[model samples]
Every structure is written in structure tokens, then in C-alpha cells.
Target: MIKPADFDFHFKPDSHWQWVETIALPFAVPEANINGIVYLVTRPMLGVCMCDVTLYDKITDLWEDQLYVDNQQHLPCPKSLTEFSLPNGLSFKVIEPLKHYRMKYEGIDETSFDLEFFGLHEPYDCNDPNMDPLAAARNGPAWDSSWSGHYEQTYRIKGELVARGKRYKVDCVETGDRSWGSRPERDNASIIWWHAAFGENLAVHFFTKHDIAKTNEFGELVSGYILEDGKVYGITSARGSQEYRKSIPIGGQLEVTDIRGKTFEFTYSTTNCAYWAPYPAVTYLQSAMRVNHNGRIGYGIQQLVLSRAYLGRNREALLARY
Candidate 1:
């Protein structure tokens, strides 16, 4: 179970300790052949915050010359996560911990936003004590070895955005997450975090472990939850496969069984994709996808992280293939 205090920074004694709050919001302008993603990450442990806004023009279909990034470091850290404004013109105030939050960003070149996120359901605890012992044992090491606590929630976001002298109304449902612990830099296993929402009634979030070097292997589901109507169900079993263009993920499919014995299958096609490194040792493909569940369509995002060490070991053959 998650409580109000979990939203605050959990500073450990180690120098590598960190608290992370991050979100990726997707927006599009079909008439202009543009689909864009906005990413924000805050690490109070390091007294820094970063914001990145990238716009993808479908006509050119390239990530170059379409990026805006801002970072503020060596600033004062907020005592609590409930309310704080960073030097980078990003401010966050929790209207209600774990359920509602208001965020605003300014001072970036021709990009600014004021948004409010309302949780559709209570935050899902990734480290539930009552989870299946086997599942927990298989997944705990990957997460527990790095972070002390983590949680994810789906939100209905509403607000406005001003980009390059034009204003666009913002309204969408997306997923965001929070994690706090000692984060060391090393050869961590590869992982995929993704989510899809079909209106306010149906949505799913998944975090899984994938071995990128072996492209044919299925991902091992770590933790996930399904929001169907007014209820939320824990995912009991899941198998996932991704379609890759060389080493980058282009699309994927997920089949899952919930605790209530219900099943769901979803397929997603990449609408736009870009790569970035929040930390030097890690780089990930952040893709915006058009997802299909049954006959319904929705929007989603995929984040695939691969360690630099793993890439270096396979560099010769991987580069030759690409």
C-alpha cells in the first residue's frame, strides 16, 4: 500500500542515492503531420531537474533538429515533494499526495505548459507484500537491488501548452511513476516500461525485463495492473514480444491474464520514435505508438533501456547489422 509520505524524497546515506519523479506526455497535430512527446524528470537528491520536448514531423520522420532541452543543477532541494519550484522554471504542487498534482514549466525557449493530473485510480504499488511469492522472488532482485520503493499511477491530464508562439489545448491520459533509492551505475538488466489507455474506463501499465541481445526471447513481466471500468486488477501472467528494426523496437504485442481470470491482448505500431540518454551509461528508445486492443484504438508510449556495457560487448556485430 502507498501512503502520502511516499511522495516525498527518500534520501539514503549513500552518495548514489536518488529520488526520481518522471513522466512522458504525448501530443499530436495530425494536420501538420507532427507527433510530439514531452519528458520531465526531477532528482532532488542531486539538486537537479531536466525537461525535454521533442517534436517529430512525419513528413521528414527524423528526430534531429526537433529538440528542446533544459536542465537546472546545483539548486536548493525542496524539503518535501508536496510543493516545490525548481530553478529551471518547473514547479510541482501536490493537491493530494498520490492522487492529484499540478505542474508548470516556463523559461524554456518558446515552450511552456501548465497542467493538472488527476489520478483515475489509486497508485499501484509495485512492491506489494501480498503478491505471489514466486513472482516477487523473480522480480524483486531487479528492482530491490536498485530502489527501495516505487509506484506507478495513471492520470487524466488537462491543461494548455504554448510552443513556438502557438497555443495548443492539452488533454490526455498518461502514466507517470516515482521511485526512490540508491541508484548505482552498473551493467543493469534491460527493461521495458509502457502503458496504454482507452478512455477513462480501460487502461493497462506494464514493466518487464527483456534481454535485448537475444531478440527472439519473450519479456518477463515484473508488475502491472489493469483498470477496467471502476475496478483494478493485478496482472498474474503476461508474455510480450517486440518487433525490431535492427536493434530498435518498432512495435510490440502483449497478452496478459489478470487475477480475476480475464485475458487481454494488445498490439501497438510505432507512430514516432526517438532515442536519448538521461544518464551516460543508459540510453533508451522513447516511442509514441498507436495501440489496438480488440477493435479499439488508443495512444501509448514505450521506453526501452539498454546498458552501455551490453552494447559495447556486442558492438561489432550490432553495428555491422545496422
Candidate 2:
């Protein structure tokens, strides 16, 4: 029912409440000045589910993992949304949607994090047993959402971060016919684990460092152009390169070579490693995050912007309230 092109180019929200609580963009640069911190929530559930809440700081360079919300046993699990945080005690919360999955995020201090009132939504995507990334990104989920999740852990070895966590990733992908010129590029994305957080900041900067793989062969393409106004650059026009300054199951240095050929670099770093399940059954990959653009010498990060919402639904709505 939601055609990608039918959406607004900038941002669009539904009614007084927003259909898009927040979008999960891979990584891109925008003219908009995203200098403050960003609070993001992701829930994967139609039945039992798990949610990830992340706190990303722009100016100070931080992306902290406050907590992981578990709602596997509760039906229509309810959660309170998170308001962005400022170090000076200037913090806030946004009202959750009335009839959709909502989030609960709050910070009581520097040491503790909490995810209150939270609910579960049906999977925005599922995959056909035969589809791939290019197809799935374009056609939406493939199979019916049946995967659950597990606990997470992280660490590093010889500069490379090792990790394992559980969350549904793709088992098989159907690569038959895809719609709207999007069959050859499909692959599974949803990961239960990524990399370990590092540095004093505990955040991952785009391509600076800590560039590891999220999916098997589809992780390094997550860079986009950003503008000076804190506005995010579009993905169709994004390009960059990376290097493997480190070694392990997955480690490398990343760079972006846009159409202009100009390049910016950052060092990716990670620590606090551990092992667990990649999801509920498959034991192929690990999940964790590290300090991005924080490594002095090497390492890196990656992502992609598959689809987007009308910009009107983005910051304008958030800014309108402030």
C-alpha cells in the first residue's frame, strides 16, 4: 500500500501522529546540521519481539547503547518513546503514536539507561526464501516474520572486534522476479549483532573506522552525502571507498569516492567483544559496534539508504514542536 515513489521527497508524516516514528537510514551526509544527539528505536515483531535503542551524539562524537528492550512474552508490548538528551541536563521526550508501535526512552544519569513503555509492531519487512538484498530492499520483506532474538555480547582481539548476538537475519533469499527494476540488488539486512562500541565516546562514526560487515556480501555500501545545513544527502548519489587496516573475520578502512572524487577519512575502533548467536538458529555471523571515525590509525564502518520518507516527516515535525 505504501509505494516508495508515492511518498513525499523530503519527509511526510501521517495525521497528528507520525506513521514513521523514525526512519532507519543507512548512512548519509546532509546539508542539515545534525550536530546534536540522535535517539533511535528499532522494533522487529508481529508476535514476540526485541528492540534496540541507540543514543547517537553528533558534536561530542558518541553513539551509546542505552538498553535492549525485550518484549518476546508480552503481546502488543508497550513502550515509552525516548527524547533526545543533552549533557547540561537539557533532555526531553516525544509522545508515542496512539495506534502504532511506540518507544520509551529516558536517561536518569550517566551510568544507567532505560526503555520504558514500549509496544511491538508487525515486521515492516519479511523475505521470500529466495530473494536477496536488492530484491528485498525494493520489494520489502520476503518470508513471513517468524524469527525471534537472543542476548548480545562484544569484545576485540588484536584490534579487531569479535562478537555474536541473536536477532533474525535472512535464512534464504528468493531471486526470481522483482518489481520496479529491483531484483538483481536484493539481499537480507536485519542483523541481530553488528560490532562492539569503543573509544571514550562509545559511538561509531560512519566511515571513519570500525567498518565491518553487517550482512555477508552487502555491508560496505552505506555512505551518502551530507550537506552543511544538517540535512542528509541523498543515497542514489552516494559513493565511497574503504581499506582493511585491520584483520579478523571482518575489519577494514573505509572511504567514500563520490562523483566529485573528493574523499574524507575516519578511523574505526572497537572493543568489548563477546560471542553469542547471530539469530535464533543460524550461527554464521556476529553482532556488535565500535567507535567510528574514532580510530586514529584504521578500522571503519558502513551502511546504506535503501528507501526514504518525505523530508517533511523528518526534522520539520520534530523542529516544529521545539
Candidate 3:
């Protein structure tokens, strides 16, 4: 396992309170591309709507005490949740919401007529630093690791199955809880989840969000395995793992898959994550990701490689180096 220090582990300004500014996609194509600035900021974890996860709250987790316990951290009751998504293929999407978000997917074939209701909370104020501004956006029903978050997106498009989603309805129970505990305990034990329903597979990816550092940078570690068709097994990348393959324009190419560190082929390009600057000199990291599972070669694996400097600074970088 690689340590955080391996990545240089330093922010641009290295301040507590940070801000995120977005630049709209100007060029044409499909979907709306938005550029975002992820500064070291702390804000409320509020957003679209609140959720009701009384189901898990009633249960018991060993780390309940260590969870965020301020007034805003706990909202006694859960409320109706708001669904955030890019209805028109990829029009507008939810980015770095204060707290985490959830998504649910439903469809029959690979592509054609399907729906995904993704939701999140409003981000906290960008000016504040004394507290976590990003997490201030959360609403009713305290956000707990036991409940974790949710996700809903199409696995396949035309009848082929995306490696992660084949046929399943993933859930998050222990994840949200374990997310509040220590790393060893959290990573060692997790009830992660992933759900999908497609032509050749029914897959899911689940894991616990362990704490990254006591500095409060992040109290979650994300890991899980992508189980497709009950035969293919792809373990997820641990938390704080960001792989920058190649630079593109705004809403560029993004490689999203499980199977880590393996030799495979990539026939598709990223459309959402590569953001372009006015002069093409700089670009932001677009959250949009689209990788075709049946892109000529069918599927691929992750190839980890390092470099002295690629994205400007000097350090080790991970890319789809196939």
C-alpha cells in the first residue's frame, strides 16, 4: 500500500478554509461541463434535500462516539432527499457537495431509456475556515458513515455490461459507520456496496471510508471490489487515490474502473473530467466520467506508473499507463 506522503501531500496554499469556483463549459458538444476549484475550505454539508436513514441509526456501530457530534452534525430526524443528476446524458452534474451524496439507477437494456437520480447537500460557505465549510452543507438526519452515501448510474449502454454495474441494487450500512472510526479498524472491516444490472453481468462495489488523517482532512477511506457476473473481481483503489492519466480539455477523459494495477487496453476517451483553460494552458478536473465497457476492446484494467512531473509539480503520479 502506498502512503499519502508518496503523493507530496501538500495543497496549493495549505490553508484550512478553501473555496471552489466553477467555470461553465463554452464549447459545444453534449452535456454541460463545469470547471471547479477545490481549495482547502470548510463549509456546511447541506444540499438538494435531507435523507432519512433512521434504519441504521437504530442499529449500533462501535464508532458512533467518534462521529461528528456538533449541532449541525446531527439533525435528529431524516427528511425527503433531493435527486441530483444530468438528465440530458451529461448536462449538469453534482460536484464536491458539502457532504457525500447518493445515486440510484434503474433500466432494462444497456442504453436507450433509463434513469438515475443522484442527490447531494449544499456546500458550506467558502469564506469560513474555523470549521469544515464543505461539510456544513449537510441537512436533516446527521450524516453518518454507517449510512455512507449513494450512487446510481448506468452500467451498460447498448447491451454490453460495464465492469462495475451489471445487475444489482447496492446498499450502504456499515460503511457510513465505519467511516467515522480509525483506519486499521475501518479498512480491515467494511460492509461496502455496489449495485448494477446489465446484459452480461450484475455487479457491485462496496467498502469502508476510513479516516485519512486526524487533521480532519477527511474521515473516510473508500475501498471495495467490483464483482461482475459473479466471476470478475476488481478491487477498488483506496481513499485519496487520484490517477491523472492524460490531460485533455474541459470535460475530458476519465478512467473509472476497479481492477487495479493490471495490463489492459483503453479504446475510449474521457469526455467530462478534462477541463480546458481559456488559453489551453490550464484546465480543471471535471467530475464527469464516461468509459464504455464495450469500447471495441470490451473491458480494461488499471496500470499504475509514476513520473517526476507531469501536471506541473514534481512528485509521483498514477495514470492508466497501459
- Each model's TM-score, in the order given? 0.86, 0.33, 0.25
For residues 1-322, write the lDDT of model 2, one tens digit per residue. 2222311111123221211122221111111211111222222122111222222212121123212211122122223233333332222343443212122234333322221212111111112212112223533332112111111111111111111221121111001001111111122332212221222122222211122232213233322332212222222222233232121122333343333344544333322111212123222121122324433332222222111122223335424432
* Candidate 2 Cα misplacement greater than 4 A, ranges: 1-48, 52-75, 78-229, 235-251, 259-261, 275-322
With a 3 Å backbone cut-off (N, CA, C), the pairs that clash in candidate 1 are none
Residue 143, candidate 3: C-alpha displacement in angstroms: 17
lDDT by residue for model 1 (92-203), tens: 7999888888888785568777888888888777787554222466545326544456777888888877776677776777777776655555776678888888878898
Instruction: Judge candidate 1 at residue 78 and give its lDDT.
Output: 63
Ranking by TM-score: 1, 2, 3
Over 1-322, each residue of candidate 3 has an lDDT whose tens digit, in order, gives 1121211112134322221111111111112221111111111122111111100011112212211111112222112112232221221222223233323222222311121222111211111222222223444212232212222121221111111233222221110111111011111221112222222343332233322111111124233333344344343233322233342211112222455453222223333332212112222222222234444212211111111123334222223221
lDDT score, candidate 1, position 261? 86
Worst 10 residues of 3 by lDDT: 174-183
From the highest lDDT down, the ranking of the candidates is 1, 2, 3
